[model samples]
Target: MLQSSVTPHPERDRLMTRTRRIASRLRDLRSAAGTLPDAVVLLDHSQHVRWFNHAAEELLGLKRPRDRGRLMSDLLRHTELAPWWIDGAREPLNDVTAPGHPNRHVTATLLPFGSRQRLLLARDTSHLTRLEQIRRDFVANVSHELRTPLTVIHGYLELLDPEDVPELAPVLDEMRAQSKRMGQIVEDLLTLSRLETQDHVADEHVQMVPLLASLRKEAEALSQGRHTVTLDVVAPIDLLGSPKDLHSAFSNLVSNAVRYTPTGGRIAIRWAPSESDGATFSVQDSGFGIPAAHIARLTERFYRVSSSRSRDSGGTGLGLSIVKHVLNLHQARLAIESEPGKGSTFACVFGPDRLLRGTQAAEAAAAGVPY
Candidate 1:
């Protein structure tokens, strides 16, 4: 009777074999993940912790069984992480202090996986953060140290008359110009350093109308009647920021346009409303436009699109870098659009929180009328 019941089932055997292979592969994957230096956490659709690796246990203080099925936000308890997690992980949260290891700084990123699951990855960035701080400190110290010497040299050059040394007049003039440029460079560096160290700018009512007018006047003065410079106030909205910092940023954009645009070229400065109720200060110039490749790196310190051209234009190559730092402090962004031979546009965009509308304009909006 037992021998009669013994029958071969090939399909069933193959199915069992395949199941064993799948389980083995999953184990291998878990082992590999556990060995990774970066913290790896698997989450369910609701962002509850499903599983985590050894690194996650050490870095994020996620204990097995105890942390399983717990909400990620509840465990992390970071204000910045909450917004980042809720916003569908649009951007990474940098310099996050690890909950488990408070001394460790981590950059966290989230990515969607199969079956509505997600993966949270965090990498230690403490070393990078320290290195960046060191760089900033070095720049600030060097700039401070050089200021007095530069001032002395510039003053002595100013005292010397070019006419007194007629044979060496050209040399004297060139030396004076270069020394002046160096002094400006040092000032800009100090400004940039200060901006870099600050997390926010002073919240002051920045009157845009007069500021824009002043910027236009400065641009015209810099242009020296060589370019057609105009200002259009499309939106009569002010901003809440440090007036001095805002002026420096706006002036950099306007001066760049004036310096780069050829004679008889058109440079238009416009203050207008942007998307999401934000305000934008844009400088559009019909000058030699930047190449696509060079535009992304324009804000880097001492970055030059054309070294000879920049030097001929008397640019210290730090204007855009300073502008970037100033805008960052003001919670604004710089957007640059350019096409070769056609033109270029540099726009400083500020969020709605920074906008300050006049009382009349606010009343007009409430009455459904354009002011």
Candidate 2:
């Protein structure tokens, strides 16, 4: 259709004519990109393909000497690009899968040349598409998990008869506790998801003294009669980051310490700045510590060391997972120290670059990094 009566260019009009010729190469053809020869392909009467690049052969398996003189549709008729060859555009595409390259997606822009010339631009977006799919799937799975417990609680309550089940009080109490645990788990999952997706997080200068005092108070409140915690500040630390985020992070670790420690066991919160050059906060506890075999999976969603024990202790199984995500967001790191019978310590290590001084923090703000 493009190969109509188009006039040939005059010899004196080389620069103007060629630039205009390329500028007019706007055909909405999807069958584009991957120039095997890098030479021009004359699609219609007066318009030629100005150039092609190397990706053509690998992506589409097209070659110049072999494919030249052929109609454009004949060369790309079997591809996802085919629909665009006949029509200028195709309807919005789902993933455009090729036989040899399964689960692949590509994009192209069209250009017009003379009456009917078109240029194809292409890129592989398969990896990005797959990742988005996975994120969606994860979100769905979490939603389903959260809904199950609520459903069970609703069903059980609907069947409850107070007069007939007066002796079932303890069972109902357990049900209520389990429902609360499920709610806690769901909340933690949402929190972890937010932390993972957040574009920016402030890690500000947090002084050690006040943080220790606050943490001690919180630990004492959480420990109650389970264990008495002793506060220990090793290296009087000054950290640069969001104090609130750090507070939550250390709170989670220290709360875990208080919750898991046996009666009369020691729980300690400590801060140290390493010449190895970073800041570290550790919450250590003489609890019924985790076994060597089960440490690595402590951060996985819903993973637990002992299901019954964790349930009895009201563990949501997402505390450490939250810790990991929070630390990673600030470009900080994590370490877990434990012995099966002794105790466990959860520590977060911050790089020296992140531990900026008050002046440096101010300078960074002025310089546009904003800490």
Highest lDDT: give the candidate number: 1
> In candidate 2, residue 255 scores what lDDT?
83
Relative to the true structure, candidate 2 reaches a TM of 0.57
Off by over 4 Å in 2: 1-133, 136-168, 356-371
TM-score of each: 0.91, 0.57
Best by TM-score: 1
lDDT of 2 by residue, 1-371 (tens): 57768677677579887777766664312134333322123455432334454565444445656655556666667887777656854443344654246556655445556666665545566777889768956975776677776867757775776568889877876776677667676777677777766756775556657878899999888878668778777655466667777777888898888877888889988777765778788888888888878888888877988888777778888888888878877778788878987999888888887675557655655665521
Give candidate 1 misplaced runs (Cα > 4 Å). Answer: 1-10, 100-102, 360-371
